[model samples]
Target chain A: MYVQRNRSLSIRSRRDPPANRHRFSISTFRGMQQPELSRKMGKMIKSENSAIGAYEAAGRERSSIAAQLSDWGESTDDDTVSDISDKLGVMLAEMGELEDVFAQNLEDYRGVLKQIRNMESSVQPSREQRQKVTDEISKLKYKDPTSARLETLEHELVRAEAQNLVAEAQLSNITRQKLKEAFDIHLAAVVERSEKQTIIARHARRLLTFIDDSPVVPGDARPAYDHETEARQVLEDAENDLRGWAPSVEPIPTSAGQESRVNGVEHDSDGLTTGLGSATGAGVSQPMTNGGPSAKKQLEEPQSQSQTEAEPIAY
Target chain B: MYVQRNRSLSIRSRRDPPANRHRFSISTFRGMQQPELSRKMGKMIKSENSAIGAYEAAGRERSSIAAQLSDWGESTDDDTVSDISDKLGVMLAEMGELEDVFAQNLEDYRGVLKQIRNMESSVQPSREQRQKVTDEISKLKYKDPTSARLETLEHELVRAEAQNLVAEAQLSNITRQKLKEAFDIHLAAVVERSEKQTIIARHARRLLTFIDDSPVVPGDARPAYDHETEARQVLEDAENDLRGWAPSVEPIPTSAGQESRVNGVEHDSDGLTTGLGSATGAGVSQPMTNGGPSAKKQLEEPQSQSQTEAEPIAY
Candidate 1:
C-alpha cells in the first residue's frame, strides 16, 4: 500500500505540479512551441536598443554640428555663431544624458520582467502537494477561530483607512496653505512694484503737463531767453519763492476749554464765530477781521472788469 | 449796376426761402422731395424706441431678481439650490441692465443723429451766397503779403496742435499711472485678504488634525463639547506642551557688546537656543545649561519614537 501511495503521489506530481510550477511549465511549453513570440520579443528588444543607439547618434551629430558652428577659424561671425553653437552643444549633452537614462530605464524594465517570470515559476507547486496543503489549511482553519483574527484585521484595516484619510487631508491642507502663502507673497510683490511704477508714471505725467502748459515767453525783461529755459527758470523761481516762506514759529495756545490751534484758528462745526479770540493774540493777520470789506470790493472790481472785457474777445 | 446786383440778390433770396418760412424755397423744395426718407427714419426711430422699452422692461425684471437673490434672506442656506438661484438671479439682472443700457445708447444715437441733421441744415448756406463767399475767400488768398490776422491764426493753430499732442501724451501717461495705481491697490487688497484667508485655513487645518489625532475617545469626551471647541482644546494643549518643552528662544547681541536677554521665543531660523548673558555679568548660563540638555533629550526621544511608530502607520 505504501509503495502504491508513493507511486500515486509521484504520478500526481507528474500530472499536476503546484499551481505556480504548473504555470511555469505551461509557459515553458508555450515558449518552446511559439518560437515566433520569442522572435517578436527579441525584435522588440533589438528595436528599443537601436532606438537608443539612434538617439545617441543624433546627439553626436548635433555635437558635431555645434563644433563646426563654433569653429572660429572657418567663420568670420564667430561671436554670434559660437554663442548659438555653445547653446546647441549644451542641448546635445543633455539629450545624450536623456538617452542614457532612457536606455537604463529600458534595462530596468527588462530586469523587472525577468523577475516577474521567475516569481511566476517559483509560485507554482505540484498538484498533489497543493491538494495536501489545501487539506492541511482547511484542518487548521477548523481548529483555529479565524473569525476573531479576521475581525481584528478588519478593525485594524478600518482604523488604518481612517488614518490614511486623515493623513491625506492633512497633506492636502498643507499643500494648499503653502500655495496660498506663495500666491499672497507673489501678489504683494506685484502690487508693490505696480504701485511704484504707478507713482513714477504719475510724476512723469505731471512733468509732461508742466512742460506742455509752461508759458512760451517770460516777462518782457527776459524776452531774449529761449521759451523753455525761461519757463523753467520761472518755475524754479516760483518753487524757490514758495520754499522761502517761513513756517509759523508762534506757540500754540494751551488755554483751558480753548480749541486746538491747527495752522490757524479752528472753527466749530456750526459755522459760527466761536474760535475768533485765539487768532487775535497771534501775529498772523486774519483776513476775515480787517480786510473783509476791502477784499469784497477788490473781488467785485475784477469780476466787473472780466465781464466787460469778455465780449471783445468773443468775435 | 448796384441796382441790378440788388435785384439779383433779392431774386435769389426769394427763390430760396428758409425751411422755417411759410413760403416754399428751392432748398425747402429739395428737402420736401425726401418725404419717403423721412418716413423711413421715423419708422426706424419708432422701432428703436420699442426695442429700448423692451430692454428697459427686461432690465427692471433682472434688477428685481438680482435684488431678491442678493437679499439677506437668500444667504441663509449653504446649499446648491440657493447658490444656483443666486447665480441665476445675478445673470438675469446683468442681462436686463445690459439691455436697458443698449436701449439708452440707441436713444442717444438717435438724438445725435437728429442734432447732426439740424446742424447740416442750419449750416447749408444759400447756393448763390455760398458762391459769393467762396469768391471772396479766393480773393483774400490772392492778396499780396498775407494778412497779419491770418498769420496769427496759423500760429495759434500750430500752437494748438502742439498743445494737443503734448496733452495726448500727458493723458496717456496719466491713464497708465491710474491703471497701474488701480491694479496695485486691487492686488494689494487681494494679497492681504488672501494672506488672511490662508492663515485662517492653515489654523483650521491644524485644529482639525489635532482633533483627529487626539487620544481622547470621542464617546468618552464630554458630549456637550462641540467639534470646534474640541479642536481648539487640542490645539491649545499641543501649544502648551510645545511651549513647555521646545526651546525656540534666541539671543540677540546688543550694540554695546552686551548680551541681551530674550525669552518666550516662538520660532528661529536656525536651531533653538537659550537667553543671552546680562550686560555686566560674566559666566552666564547659555543654551544647554541646567535642564536644557535633558529637556531637549526628552523632547527628541518621544518625537523619534512617535516617528518610528508612525512609519508603518503611514504605509
Candidate 2:
C-alpha cells in the first residue's frame, strides 16, 4: 500500500511547450499553410477538437468502468458487497452520463469558435487583395509618373480598401461576439457539471457507509446484509437531485444590438454587404440572442428517462 | 446553431452490455486467465486503469487547449481580449491540473483494489487444494475400498480444510476493509474535484464578463480595452479560493476496530494464522487508520507555485 502519488504538476507540462503541441503532424502542416491573419484562431479551433474528443473518450471509459464494477460486485457472492457495489455502479454510471452531456455542451462551444475561425479565414483574402493593389499602384507611380494605368490602379485600390474595410469590420464584430458566446457556454457547462457531479458523489459517499468493514475470525460467518432498502434509497435520491438540477450560473450580458450592426452597414456608404460571402454581418443586424442555446436550455429540457419509473434500479 | 445534442442516454448504454466491455482484447485474455475467485476483481482493477488513463489524457489536452486559447487571443491584437484570454487560460490550466490530481487519486484507489485481488488469488489455491483432497478420498473409496491411501488423504483433507477456512476469513476481512478504504479515497476525490472546479469555473465566468462583446460599425473603432485591473483580480480571487479550499464531505465510518481482527484470531481455537502466506491477516489486527492519506491530505498540501509571486501571468 505504498502509493507514490504525483503531488506536483506533471513533468510533461513543464517540459513541453503548449504552443507547439503536435507540431510535426499533417494537421500542423495544414495549420502552417493558413493565412497569417487567421493562423492562431485556426490552430485554437483544431486543438479544441482534440479537447472535445478527449472528454468524449473519458466519458466512454467511465461508463464502461461503472458496468464492470457492478458485474464484479455480483460475482463476489457476498450479499452486502453485491448489493452496495451494484448500487454504487448505478451512481457511477450516472456520473458517466454527466460526462457525456458535458462533452456535448463543449461541442456546441467549439462550433461557435468555428464561426470566428471561418470569419478570420474569409477576412484574410480581402486583406491580401487590398495590400496587393495598394503595392501595384505605388509601384506604377514610382516607375512611370504619367502612366494612365496608375489612375486605374488607384481606383482599384480604393475599391479593394473599401472591401477590406467591410471585411475587417465583420471580422472584429464576429470575433468578439462569438468568443463571448463560446466561453459563455463553455464555463456554464463547467459549472453545471461540477454542481451535478457533486450531488451524485455526495450521495455516492452515503452508499459507502452501508458497507460494514468489521473483520471476522475463522469459521465465523457475517450476518445477513439487510441494507438493501437503504442502498436503493441512495439511488432514488441521486435520480431526483439530477432531475431537479438547474443552471445556477450568472447571466453573461452582451451588447451586440441591431443598431450597431445593420445601421453600421446602411449608414456607412462604403459598408456594402455585396461581394462578401453571406458571413459578412449576416446575423449582426439582428438582436443578440443567446447564441446556440446556452447551457441553461439543456438543463431546463426534460431528461430522456421516464419520470414514471417508480423503481430506481430498472437496469 | 442547430445543436443535435445527445440529450437521451447514449444508445451504447442500452445495447452494449457493460458486463462484456472490450472482451476480445489481449487484456481480456489475461483477465480470463485469472483464477475464478479473483477474476471479477481482476477485471475491475484493469478497467479502473483505463478510466484513470482517460482522465490523464483529458488533463493534458485541457492544458494544451488553455495555452492555445491564450495564444489565439494575443494574436487578435485587441488589448481586452488578450488580457482576458490569458487570465482565462490560467484558470483553465488550473482545471487541467485538477484532472491530473484526480487521476492520481484514482491510481491510489486502484492500488487498494489490487490488495483485494492478490488476497483472492492466494485464497483460490487453498480452496482448490481442499476440494482436490476431498475428491481424491472419495474416488479411492469407490475404486479400491481397501486402499491405505484413503487414510492419508483424509488427514490431508483435514489439514486442507483448516487452511482453507483461514484463507476464506482472510479474504472476506481484507475484501470488506479494503473495498471501503478504496472507495473512501475515490468518492472523496470526486468531491474534491467537483468542489475545486466549481470555484475556478465561477471565477472564470467572471473573466468572461470582462469581454466587451459589443459590436462595432464598419470603420468605427472599439473603445480602448480597459478591464485589466478587474480581470487580474478574478485570478487572484480564484487562487485564494483554491488555496483556502478544503474537504467538506461527510466522513465515512469504519467499524474495523482492532479487537474484531486480532482478538477474533486470539479467541478462536481454530484460527491459527499459519500455512497461508503473510497475506493472511498480516495488518488486519493492527489499528484501523485512514488508508493512503485520503483526499484531505492532498488538499492540505501546499501547491508547487510560490505564494510570493505577485504577477499571475509569469508564463
Candidate 3:
C-alpha cells in the first residue's frame, strides 16, 4: 500500500507509451539465431545488456543534473542557497557514481550467465547426434532386415549413445555449477548497491538541514548566511562516511566442482570416456547418490581405462 | 580500490560504443526555450525525467530476464534448477518493481523542483520592470534636470522598486523551501529502495544454497532433487520479508514558511506589497534575524497595514 501511494504520484497515468511497447531490434534476431538449447539464455543475456545500458545512461544524466543544480544555485545570488545547493550537488554526484559502480557489478554477473549459455550451445550438438543415429538405425532396420550394413549401423548407435552419455553428464555438471556461480555474483551485487546508496542518501539529508528556509519580509534583508562553514562540514562528513564504508553482506558458499567423481573418471586420448560401455558390461550398478565409493574404486582399476580407449567416438 | 577490482570483471573492455554517446530529442529543445531565469532548473528537470525513464526501462528489462531465467531452468529438465530459478525469478521481479516505485518517488521530487522554477519565472518580470524604470529615470534626468515629468518618473521608480523587493523576497522564500522539500523526498526514496532490495537479495541467496552442484560421472545420473520444498520455502520467506519491510530513514526537518514576517505583510488591491516605501519613511529598520519580534509588534499595530495599502504597483 505504501508503494501504491508512491506509484500514484507519477504525472503520466500510464506506465509507458503504447507505441514504445515493442521495438524489435537486431538483438532479438540474434537470440532467434542461437541454438534451441541456448536460445533462452541468449535472450536473457541480451535483455540484461539493455538493462545495464539504461543504468549507465541514468548515471550519466544524474551527474549532469547535479552540475546543473549547482549552476542554478550560483545564479540565484543568495549565499545560503548557493552554499547548500553546491554541497548537495556533491552528494548527488557521488550517488550517480554509485550507479555507475553498480552497473559494473551487474556486468560481472552477466559474464557468468554467458558461461551457462555457452555450455548450452556446446551440449546441443551431442543431443542432435544421438537422436540422428537412433533414427537412422531404426529406419535402416525397418527397410531391410537381411542387410550386412545393419551391423555397421548398430555399431554406430552404440558409439553415439556412449558419446551422448558423456555429453549429458558434462552438461549436468556445468549447468548446476555455473547457475550457482552466476546468481551468487548477482545477489551480492544487489546487496552491495543497496548498502552503499543508503549510506550516501543518509548523509545527503544532513545537508538539507543546513538550509534556513524561514521566510523574509519585503524590503527587509535577511541576515548574512553564517552556515557556510557548517554546510561545507556536511560535505566533508559525507566524504568521510563514504570512504569508511565497507561491504557487510554474508557470502554465499558453494562446493560446485570440488570432490567431483567425474574429476577422477579417466578419459582416453580423444577426451572420450568409455565408462558407459565397460561399467554396463561388468554390471557395476551403483545408486546415483551412493556412486562415490565405486567411482573411486573404478578410478584405481586399470580395466576401465582400456575399455574406454577401445570405443573412441566417431563424431 | 576495492571497487576497481569489481570493475575489471566486465566482459567488455570499454564502457559503451562511441555510436550511442549522444541522441538529441524534443526534451532538449523544450529546455532551451525556457526563460533565462528558469532555464537551468528547466534543463535539470528534463534530465531527471530521462533518468527516471532509464530506471523504468531497466525495471521492465529486469522483469523480463527473471521470466526468461525460469523458462530456461524448466527446459533444462533439472527439477532442482527449475524450482530454484523459478523462485529466484520471483525475487528478481520484485526488485524490478522496486525500480518502478523509485521512479515514481523521483517524479514527486521533480514536481517540487518545478515549484522553484515557476517562482523564478514569476520573479523575472519584476526584475526587468525595476531595471527599465531606473534606466528611464536616469535618461530623463540627464536630458533635463528640471523637467516637469521628473516627479512622476521618480514616483514610478519608487513603485517599481517596491514591487521588485516583494518579488525578490517571495523568490528567496520559495527557492529554499522547495529545494529542501524536493531532496527530502528524493533521499528518503533512495533509502527505502535500498533497504527493501537488500531484504529480497539476502533471501534469494538462501535459495542458491539448495542447488546441489556436485558433479556426476557419465552413466551415473544425478540423485533426484530433494530440496524442492526447501526452495519453495525460500520464495515464501522472501515475500514475507518484503511484506514486513518498512522505511528506515531519518526524517529531514524544514521550517520554510512558518513564522514568515512576509505572511503578515498587507498587500494592496492588486496583490502588491507597499512595505518598502513606508517602512523606510517610518525608520522601522531591524536586523533580518531579529525582525521576528518587531514584525509581530508591527502585526499588532494597524499603521503598517495602512502604509502597505497606500502604494499599488502597475505591473
Tell me model 1's lDDT, rounded to 2 decimals: 0.30
| TM-score, B chain alone, candidates in order | 0.25, 0.74, 0.73
Q: Comparing only chain A of model 3 with the true chain A, what is the TM-score?
A: 0.72
Better of 1 and 3 by lDDT: 3
lDDT of each: 0.30, 0.70, 0.69
Give per-residue CA lDDT, model 2, range B22-107, as digits (tens).
Answer: 65323335434768877787777767777787777778878888999899888988898889889989988999999888988888
Candidate 2 residue pairs in clash (backbone atoms < 3 Å): none
lDDT of 2: 0.70
lDDT tens per residue, model 2, A179-249: 77788888888888889999999998888888877666566679999889998888999999989988887
- Candidate 1 local lDDT, residue A290: 28
Best by DockQ: 3
Instruction: Tell me the lDDT of model 1 at A147.
Output: 51
Distance (Å) between predicted and true CA of B64, model 2?
A: 0.9
What's the candidate order when arranged by decreasing TM-score? 2, 3, 1
The CA-based lDDT of model 3 is what? 0.69
lDDT of 1 by residue, B107-219 (tens): 45444333322222222222223345445545666784476555444333333333222222222222222222322232232223223322222332233122121111111
